[model samples]
Each structure stands twice: as structure tokens, then as C-alpha cells.
Target: MKTEKRKLAIWMTMEAIEVIGLKRIVLDRDVAEAVGFFHAVIAPQVFATAERFGIHRVDVEETEDGRLPG
Candidate 1:
């Protein structure tokens, strides 16, 4: 569960760069805070809620270069 949340937080943080417009906009402090909170807080809640919906997957599939697959 801890590992899964950490992994999900990485993916979520990357997505946040675009969704939250954090690319060079917000300070590194914001990124740090967001990542930590996502992993420690949001990720757990997400997984708990997901189980109710039959969703158990937490890993993200990516290419060798770390890019999201199409």
C-alpha cells in the first residue's frame, strides 16, 4: 500500500505539472508539498474508495523512456 501510493504520487505529480500549471509557475515548495500530500493523504483515500468500485490497479504503464503509452 505504501509503495503503491508513492508510485501513484509520482504519476499524479507529473500530471499536476499540466493540470495545475505548476511548470515554472509555482515554487518547488508547492511541488514538494503536493507530492508528499498526495502520497501520504490523497493516495490512500483514493485506493480505499477505488476498492468499493472494483478498481484495484495502481500501477501506471509507461515506455522505457518513462513516457506514458498511448
Candidate 2:
């Protein structure tokens, strides 16, 4: 089988992430695309959680690797 490369974006924050208790998240868009469904492990809003992690400001960026190295 061949794999196609793809990217996905999900809204999340440092404090609210404990709801699902996921220590890590991995992107597997190829399977997700083919299956036509996927679930995001984190919440898509940072409205209240940011302050708990000392996040004064949140900067958004476009990325390829899906890792927050930048």
C-alpha cells in the first residue's frame, strides 16, 4: 500500500488537555483521511486553560511535522 502525506490542525491548550489525559498526540492523517473520520484528543478552545500554564499570549503557526519544536 501507498501512503499519502497530509496535515491536520486541532485546537488545544496546556491546561485543558487533562480532560482526556493524553500525554502525547500523534498525527496519522493518511489513515484518518482514508477512513473519513478521526477524533481529536484535546479541546479546540483555549479560552480558559491558557492562563493556568502561564500562557499570557498564544501564537499560532502553520507547521508540517505537527510537533511544537518551533
Candidate 3:
């Protein structure tokens, strides 16, 4: 028996009153799943950070491209 290997790309953006940043991360299939699971749980804190910064409107853009990994 043989196992197949998979790779993934995860992109995240953070916008706030004082600061804004973008990130492009790559991970294996398993790690990607773990990250996805925690993302929802951690979103509140992320938003809170923006709120603490006095940002009423926080815009975020996220993307994933497994087909184009570099």
C-alpha cells in the first residue's frame, strides 16, 4: 500500500485601525486541516485585537491555492 502526499496554501489578511498585514502560508494537508479547525476558534481574538485598536470596520481577504504553490 502507498500513501499520497498533499500540499496546501493558506492566505490571511488582518486590517485594523492602526495596523494592517497580509500573510501567505503553506502547509501539508494534515496541518491545513488543523489550522482550519483553529481559525474559527481564534477569529474572535483576532477581531478583538482590531476592536482594541479602535477599528470599527475591519476588512479581511483570504485565499487558498493548492494548484499554485510556490
**Cα lDDT of all candidates, in order?**
0.51, 0.39, 0.44
Reference-based TM-score, model 3? 0.30
Across 1-70, the per-residue lDDT of candidate 2 in tens digits comes to 9998655344554455443233222243355442222223232344245555565533334435533332
Q: Across residues 1-70, which tens digit of lDDT does each residue of candidate 1 receive?
A: 4555423322223445454544443455576666655555556666666676676545434337532233
* Segments of candidate 2 deviating more than 4 angstroms: 1-41, 45-47, 51-60
Deviation from native of the Cα of residue 48 in model 1, angstroms: 0.4
- Tens-digit lDDT string for candidate 3 (1-70): 9988764333444455212111222233366644654354345565566576665633334325322112
TM-score of each: 0.41, 0.21, 0.30
Best by lDDT: 1
TM-score leader: 1
Which prediction has more favorable lDDT, 1 or 2? 1
Off by over 4 Å in 3: 1-29, 55-58, 62-70
Q: What's the best-to-worst order under lDDT?
A: 1, 3, 2
